[model samples]
Target: IIIGEKRLRQQSKDPRTPPSHQPEADITPSPSPRPRPPDNLEEGEVEEVCEISTPPSEVLVVEGQADEPFSTDHAQRLIGQIMVWNGQIDRMRDQIDSMRKRLDTMQQEIKNMIDVLGRI
Candidate 1:
């Protein structure tokens, strides 16, 4: 009888049972609590899983388009883009000026040829 009573008590204390599958039994402390679905838990009774809080970003927020809050990196990126555009525009202007000068030279040569032909 004594041996049988001891066996029953050992079984009860063994954590392999249904309700004792807790992470605490594993003995390593988790940085964050595990999350669980809210069911029959009392309003004030906090579960071990629900005790940890998550970061603000992890919490859900509704969609709304606020003016894009610009950061320094974004501003720097914008400035870089503007500089690239300005360089391209300056290159195009230089090309157009070169083309205009060539056209003017060609026109003067044609006028000189016409005058020489008239003299001939």
Candidate 2:
């Protein structure tokens, strides 16, 4: 980001100058990165599966013609969702509490059985 800012400042210093007059250091092309070869291939072998391209872009909204994207109904729906999620959380807590009680009962039964076997 700092390098880009420096380039922008350097360019703005002489905005009217032609590209040919610019210093060679700033105009040099950056190195293209090489993709690694697959392990199955022989040594020094490589394969390019795809090429990078610019992504497509489009305007999502136009001047004065854009419709209102929000409503009171959407807000109400969000509140309703919160209530539904809260109910689900309550149900999960109840189920977990019941499961803990069952586990405790099973543990007590196992201890009793062990005690009976020792007595016999």
Candidate 2 displacement at residue 51 in angstroms: 52
TM-score (C-alpha, index-matched) for candidate 2: 0.42
lDDT by residue (tens digit), candidate 2, 6-57: 1111222344652232232222232445445567888666555544332232
Native-referenced Cα lDDT, model 1: 0.55
* Candidate 1 per-residue lDDT over residues 1-120, each given as its tens digit: 011111111112334543222122122355455446478888788555423333432312223523333468887998999999999999999999999999999999999999999999
> With candidate 1 superimposed using the best TM-score fit, by how many Å does residue 60's alpha carbon deviate from the native?
27
Local accuracy by lDDT, each model: 0.55, 0.55
Candidate 1: regions farther than 4 A off: 1-67
Report how far residue 12 has shifted in candidate 1, in Å: 60
Residue 117 CA displacement from its true place in model 2, Å: 1.1
Please list the Cα RMSD from the true structure of every candidate, rounded to 1 decimal place: 26.4, 17.6
Give the total clashing residue pairs for model 1. 0
